[model samples]
Target: MLKYGVTHRLSTTYHPQTSGQVEVSNRGLKRILERTVGENRASWSDKLDDALWAFRTAFKTPIGCTPYKLVYGKACHLPIELEHKAYWALKHCNYDLKTAGDHRKVQLNELNELRDQAYENSLIYKEKTKRLHDSKIKNSVFNIGDRVLLFNSRLKIFSGKLKTCWTGPFTIAQVFPYGIVELSSTNGPNFKVNGHRLKQYFGGDIPPMVVPDLQTFPMDQ
Candidate 1:
């Protein structure tokens, strides 16, 4: 990528299945593609450039600059402006070589400041998003020896609605960071599951559960 002056960045693994910004970008692109091609979805590939141009030039309030400007360090000249000369375009067209060179240098010098301002705006945007997300999250707190319910969606296909949707009254064997807990079932296997899926078991007499034999579930799942 460095050969062509491109930078490649991997997505954060914090919660890869639910990446907010990427999903938003994909949704916006899909909307653009739908509007550009209408019912002729097969022609979307042909109109890809037009769709990209629209996205690049569109003002994004989060950073207060078009994507095109951020990448090229200057505002984009639309096709119409180039062909039929807007007022600003007309004025620029009359500039001498030295004047244009000086203007270009000045713009390049200002690019750093523009990028810094955009970076600050992005940090603020992320903090607001984090707060909004955290506000909706009711964190599940579990302690060792406490009984809790385990969500049984995987077993539901065979059992149907008549059967229990939750399987546990399982004892908490261990607690981990990021809302994960180790569970043990009486005379059965021990496993780890997300705290979101487990609720405190408050119904009846708790059974003695053992966890010497561990059955680890996929962390990504």
Candidate 2:
């Protein structure tokens, strides 16, 4: 990948949304396998190829075309369609060996253009999705000296159910761009954490509830 000028990005911990596309694809594949395997759950491995073929040939909203079409510069022919004499199949059936070979070569030559178009469509779709997501997200505004509770995300193994996951009422020491916050706690050293982990702490003493004394009077017959 380094030789081909491809850059690798690492997804942050506890944030699967960063790799949303992969997660979505995995979910789709899982659903397909669930439907195909039926009662024989262990035989899902046998249907993996069929599921993959369905996934590849199915139209993707992001790219506005099937993955197979983007790569091959033409739509994939299903077994049923080919058997039932699809237009493309019938056309190719009439063509001689040389003619069919030439047509395939033509499609291969146009594959790059098809891939470029798909890439552009994917970028546009991503931009639209980002805009929609951003519109719904309320931006967090923090300042120095503000009290905030830090979310305890590291405790994943057999944690107590009654214990609160949020750890500290740490004072914000510094607020930086792109949701980076520096926090200082009374019992711990100062540390930088993502702003998303912190929520404003409004700690104060609760007023005690008072109960009035009750007097009972005796009733005469």
Question: Which candidate's lDDT is highest?
Answer: 2
Q: Against the true structure, what is each candidate's TM-score?
A: 0.63, 0.68
Clashes of 2: 0
- Tens digits of lDDT, candidate 2, 87-176: 876665535888878888898998888888889998998888779967976787999999999888774779888999997789999977
| Over 4 Å off, model 2 | 1-11, 40-43, 92-94, 143-145, 150-177, 180-194, 204-221
**Cα distance off (Å), candidate 1, residue 88:** 4.0
Best by TM-score: 2
**What 10-residue stretch in candidate 1 is worst by lDDT?**
9-18
Candidate 1 CA-lDDT value: 0.78
For 51-123, candidate 1 gives per-residue lDDT tens digits of 8889889988777898888877788777689788798877666468888788888989999999999888877
For model 1, the superposed segments whose C-alpha errors exceed 4 Å read 1-18, 91-95, 144-175, 180-221
